[model samples]
Every structure is written in structure tokens, then in C-alpha cells.
Target: MSIIIITGGSRGIGASAAKQCAAKGMGIILTYNSHPAGAESVVRQINAVGGKAVALALDVTKVRSFAAFRDDVAKALKSTWGKDHIDGLVNNAGYGNFNAIEAVSEAEFDGLLNVHLKGPFFLTQALLPLMAAGGHIINMTSATTRVATPGAAPYAAFKGGLEVLTRYMAKEFGPRKIRANAISPGAIRTDMTSKAFDQSPEFVTLLAGQTALGKIGEADDVGRVIASLLSEDNGWVNAQTIEVGGGYNI
Candidate 1:
């Protein structure tokens, strides 16, 4: 079976992608930050359903820890899947914050950059050696890069950078037959956006109306797309940023 690693697999889009990938008969190595219990719960669910899965702790912002994390992944691969290479890597761990460019502090900006941009860049570099030929890399970006949303300036800016990086990865990794793509979700109902959905029904309604589907998306909507991208069926689709937003804002 093909083995895959997904960062931030404890909750939100990452968690959903983990489960969906497992359902596709792939062995899973999922990472969590700050929530071991949630990671364990996901592993338990996957095991209960007869799928193989393992969860490890990862603080994406801590670049110093990546070597240790890679060692742990090496161990997990050998012990669990009896393999030396991973077939897929999803850079999906991130948090959402809302602050306008003028109001955004340096600390806040650095925090987002560390997790969303720098973290993914270095982590992928650290793991690139273990990635098998024909492996796929899926970077979870945001549709905010395309749609100008108030108070999401830094987040969108970094995500836009990630989208550009995805193309570069595809170009550079093409010799190995590896592919890279970006998945951009629009106004999904996830833990990151739950507060907005809960505190302001009008905000949710406005977003829904902006979507051509007349509704917001669920985590699995994007998760399934990630799984499909990892599969051989999409082997020819590379260097693209797919918007899984149900056609938001026309």
C-alpha cells in the first residue's frame, strides 16, 4: 500500500484528509500539534475501520525540531509500513487569524509566516529525501489569495506565496516524476472559521450567498480533493492551484 504523511492531521482539513486517504487504502502517518488526544482519536478511528495509521507530534513553526521529527517518521515507516519511502506529503497544518495590514503586528505576521510558509518550506526540504519517486505533494493554501477578504491580508499574502512555491516544486521535482499542487478552499466550515459562523449568522449567510453553490463547504469537500490528487488518477494533473470553494465570488 502507498504510504502518505499529512501535517496538522488532528483536526480541520488535515484530519478530514487523513481519514479520506486512509479510506482509499493508503497507509497514513499523520502529524498533530498541541493535541495528542485528537491525533490518537483519529488513529483509533482509522484502526477501528481496519486502516493503518500513526500520529506524531509536530510544531511546524519550530524548524529546529524537524530533524527529530524526520527521525521519528523514519522509525514509523520502518516499524509500521515496512517501507523506506513515503508516497505523498500534505503540508496542511495552519491556523487562521484576521487582522488588517495596518493593524497587524510584527509578531502576528511572523507567527503566520513561520507556520504557513517557512515551516512548510523547511519541513518539505527535510522530508524530500524520503519521498519516493512519483510521490505527490499537496500544499493546503487558501482562496483568500484570490478573493480580497478584509482583515486577512497577511494570511492571504503568505498563502499566495505558497501557491507560487507549489509550481516551483512541481517544476523542480518533475525529473523524479513527482507532482505538486495547491488546494485552495473558500469559506469552509472548519474549526478555524467556527467562531465567525457561531457569533454572526449574517456573516455566514453573506459568504453562502457569495458562493454559486449557495452554501459554504465542509472539511471533507476539500479533503476528498486532496485524496484524489494523491491518487494515480490525477497523475497528469500537476502544477495547479485547484479552488474547492463551490465557485465563490463568481
Candidate 2:
């Protein structure tokens, strides 16, 4: 069976992607940050349905821990699936912050850059050796890069950087037959957006109206797409930014 490693798989899009990937008969190595219980629950759900999954702790912001994280991944691969390499890596671990460019502080900007851009860059570099030939890399980007959103300057900027990095990864890794792509989600109904949805009806309405589907996206929607991208069926697709936003902002 093909094995996949997903970062930030404790909740939101990452969690949904783990379950969905498991359902399709892939072994999952999911990472969680500050949500071990949530990660355990996701593993339980997958196991209850006869799917195999293992959760590990990973703080994407801490680049110093990546070597240890790689060792842990090696151990998990050996014990869980009796393997030495993973078939895919999903850089899906991230958080969102709302602050305009003028109001954004340095700490806030650095935090976003660490998690959204620097984290993915070094994490990929650390794990690149473990990714076998034909492996795929999926970077989670945001539709905010395409359509400017107020109060998300830093977050969007880094996501946009990740999108560019995805293309570069594809170009550089092509010789190894390892494909890379970016998935830009639009207004998904995840915990990341819960505060806005719960606190501002007008903001929610505005988001819904921007979507051609007349509803906010769900985690599973983007999760399924990510899972599909990792499948062999999409082997020919690489170096592309796919916006899974229900025709958002069109």
C-alpha cells in the first residue's frame, strides 16, 4: 500500500484529508500540533472503519525539530507499515490570522511566515530524501492569493510564496519523477474560519455570495480533492495550482 505523510492532520482540511486518503486504501502518517487528542480521535475513526493510520506530534514552526521528526517518521514507517519511505507528503499544516498590512505586527508576520512559508520549505527539504521516486507533494495554498482579502496580508503573502515554491519543486524534482502541486482552497468551513462565521454574519454572507455554489466549502470538499491529487490517476498532473473553491470570486 502507498504511504502518505500529512502535516497538521489533527483537524480541519488536514484531518479530513487523512480520513479520505485512508478510505482509498492508503496508509496515513498524520501530524498534529497542540491537538494530540484530536489526532488520536482521527486515527480512531479511521481504524474503526478498518483503515490504518498513525498520528505524530509536529510543530511546523520549529525547524530545529525536523531532524527528530524525520527520525520519528522513519520509526513509524517501520513499525506501522514496514516501510522506509513515503509515497506522498502534504504540506497542509497551517493557521490563519486576520490583520491588515498596516496593523500587522512583526511577530504576527513572522509567525505567519514561519508556519505558511518557511515551515513548508524546510520541512520539504528535510523529508525530500525519504520521498521515493514518483512521490507527490501537495502544498496547501489559499485562494486569498488570487483575490485580495482584507486583514490577511501576511497569510496570503506566504501562501502565494508557497504556490511559487510548488512550481519550483516540481521543476527541480521532475528528474526524480516526484510531482508537486498547489491546492488553493476558497472559504472552507473549517475551525480556522469559525470565528468569522460565528461572530460576523455579514462577513459570512459576503463569503457565501462570492462563491458560485452559494455556500461555504467544507473540509471534506477540499480533503477529497487533495486525496485525489495524491492518487495514481493524477500522476500526469504536476506544476499546477488548482483552486478548489466552487468557482469562488468569479
Candidate 3:
């Protein structure tokens, strides 16, 4: 069976992607940092549907842990799916910290940098050996990178770097038949952003007004896209940033 790893697969886009990919017959090895319950719930949902899935702990901010995490992934692949390599990886683990640039501290800046850009780079490097031929790598970026939203300067800048790094991953890993792409999601309703939407109905309405679709996206909106990109049907799609934001700020 084809196997894939999704970081931050406990909730939101990653969790939805794990379920969708499993439904398509891909074995899943999903990672979570603190939300073990959410991760296990996702695994159970996949297994309930007769799909194979497993969850592991991963803190994306710690680059030092990737090697060990890779080891854990290898064990999961062998034990769960009897596979030695993974066909895909979705670097979907991240958090949101909205702070103006002038008020953003160095610690906050470094934290965002570590998770959004630096961690994906190193984690992919650590896991590259176990990636099979024709494997795909996905980097979850943001529409904030393009829209210049005020309190998200550091986050947007880091996601922008990740988008660029996606292109380079495609360029460098192309010879190995591994494709790379970025999914820039606009205002999406996930646990991460749900509180904001709940806090301000006006904020949600304003964002919806700016979007061409007249609505913010759900986790499924982006999840299905991630699964589709992992499929053989979209092998020709590479090194491209496909925004799934309902055409926000257009």
C-alpha cells in the first residue's frame, strides 16, 4: 500500500487530509504535537472505514527531534503497512500568532520561523531517505503571505519563505521523481481560526465579502486538494502554489 505522513494531522487541514487520503487507499502515518486525542480520533475514523492509519507525536519547532521522528516513521511504516518507504509527506504542522511587527518579540519571530519554514526544510531533509521514488512533498502556506494582513507579519513572512522553498524542493527533488507544491489557503474555518470567527462575526463577514466565493473555506475545502495532489492523477502538477482561498483579495 502507498504510505503518507501528515504532520499536525490531529486537527484541521491535516486531520481532514489524513481521512481523505486513507479513503483513497493510502496508508497514513499522521503526527501531532499536543493533541493526542484529536490524532487518535482521526486514526479511529480512518480505521472505522477500513482504512489504515497511525498517529505519532511531533513538535515542529524542535528540529533536533526530526531524526528520531524519522525513525519512528520508519517503524510505523514497517509495522502498520509493511512498507519501507513513504510515497508522500504533507508538512501541515503550524500555529498562528497574530502580532504587529513593531510589537513582535524576537522569541515570537523565531518560534514562527522555526515551525513554518526552518522545520519543514530540515524535516523533509531528515525524511528524504525514506521517501520512495515519485514521492510528493506538500508545504502548507497561507494567503496572508499575499494579502499583507496587519497583525500577522512574522507568520506571513515565514509562510512566504516556505512557498519559495517548495519550488526549490521541486527543482532539487525532481530528478528523484518527487514533486513539491504549496497550498495557500485563505480565511479558513478550522479550530485554529474558529475562535476568531466566533469572537467577531464582523470579521468573518468582512473576509467573506473580500472572497470571490463569498465564504471562507472549511477544512475539507483544502483537505481534498491535498489528497488530490498526492494522487497519481496530478503527477504533472509540480512546483506551483495553488491558492485554495476562494479568491480572497482578488
Candidate 4:
């Protein structure tokens, strides 16, 4: 079975992707930092349906912890699937921040930078040794990179960086046959974005109005795309940024 590691797999797009990947017969090692309960719940959901999944704790911002996290991943692979290698890594762990460029503070910028770009860079570096030849790497980015969302400057900037990094990863790892790609979703109803909706109720309707599909995206909408990207069927599709939005801002 293909063994995959999905970061931030406790909820939102991460959790949805974990379950979807499991549904397709992949062994999942999902990571959660603050939401153990949510992670366990997802494991149970997968197990109840006869799918195999395991949850581990990971704080993506702490580059120091990545070496240890890779070790834990090694242990999980050995123990759970009796495998010594990972087939794929989904760098999906992230949060949302909303502030215009002029008003954005340094802490906010650094926080977004740490989690969205720096964390994924070092984490991928740390895990590359354990990743098998032909392994896939999927970086979760944001469509805000293209849409120029007013309050998402820092977050969008880092996601844009990650998209660029994905291409580089594909170029560099091509010799190893490890493919890398970015999935850029627009206006998904995730925990990170919902927090903003709590403060501004019209945020949802406004986004929906802007979308060609006439609705905000659900977690599973993007999840299915992510799971499909990790599958062997997409092996030839590399160094691409697939926008999974329902035609948002277009």
C-alpha cells in the first residue's frame, strides 16, 4: 500500500484529505499539533470503515522538531505498515491570518512565514531521506496568491513562495523520480477561514457571490483533489499548481 503523511490532519482540509486518501486504500500517518482529539476522531472514522490510519503530533513551525518528527514518522511506518519508506508527503498544515499590508504587524508576518513557507521547506528536507524513490510531494497553497485578497497579504505571500518552492522541488527531485506539485484552493470553508466569518458574517456570502459555482468550497471539495494528486494515476503530472476552486474570481 502507498503510505502517505499528511500534516495538520486533525480537521478541515487535512482531515478530509486523510479520510479520502484512506478510502482509496492508502496507509495514512496524519499529524496534529493542538488537536489530538480531532486527530483520533478522524482515525476512528477511517478505522470504522476498515481503513488504516495513525495520528502523530507535529508543530510545523518548529524547525528543530522536524528531525524528531521524521523519526516518529519512521517509527509509525515501521509499526503501522511494516514499511521503512513513505510514498508521499502532503504539506497541508496551515492557518489563516487576515490583515492588510499596511496594518500587518511583524509578528503576524513572521508567524505566517514560519508555518506556511519555512516549516514546509525544512520539514520536506527532513523527510526526504525517508521518502522512497517515486514518492510524491503535494504542497497546499492558496489561490489568494493570484486573487490579491486585501486582508491576506502575508499569508498569500508565503503561499506563493510555497508554490514556487514546489516547482523547485520537482526540478531538484526529478533525478530521484519524486514529483512535487501545489494545490491552490480558493475560498474554502475551513477552520482557518471560518474564524474570520465568525467576525464578519457576510464574508461567506461575498465569497460565494464571487465564485462561478455560486458557493464557497467545502473541505472535501479540495480533499478529493489532494487524494487524487497523491495517487499513482497522477504520476506524470508534476510541477503544477492546480487551482481547485469552483472558479473563484474568474
lDDT of candidate 3 over 1-250, digit per residue (tens): 7799999999999999999999899999999999999999999999998999999999988989989999999998888877789999999999999998899999999999999999999999999999998999999999998898999999999999999999999999999999999999999999999999999999999999999999999999999999999998998999999999999999
Clashing pairs in 2: none
> lDDT by residue for model 2 over 1-250, one digit each (tens)?
9999999999999999999999999999999999999999999999999999999999999999999999999999999889999999999999988887899999999999999999999999999889999999999999999999899889999999999999999999999999999999998889788877889888878889999999889999999999999999898999999999998999
Error of 3 at 191 (Å): 0.5
Count of backbone clashes for each model?
Answer: 0, 0, 0, 0
Residue 143 of model 2 has an lDDT of 98
Worst 10 residues of 4 by lDDT: 192-201
Worst 10 residues of 1 by lDDT: 187-196
TM-score of each model, paired residue for residue: 0.99, 0.99, 0.99, 0.97
Clashing pairs in 1: none
Model 1 agreement with the true structure over 75-173: per-residue lDDT tens digits: 999999899999999999999878988999999999999999999999999999899999999999999999999999999999999999999999999
Model 1 scores a C-alpha lDDT of: 0.94
TM-score of 4: 0.97
Report every candidate's CA lDDT. Answer: 0.94, 0.95, 0.95, 0.94
Instruction: Summarize candidate 4's per-residue lDDT along 155-177 as a digit string, tens digits.
Output: 99999999999999999999999
lDDT of 2: 0.95
Error of 1 at 47 (Å): 0.6
Q: Which stretches of candidate 4 lie over 4 Å from their true place?
A: none
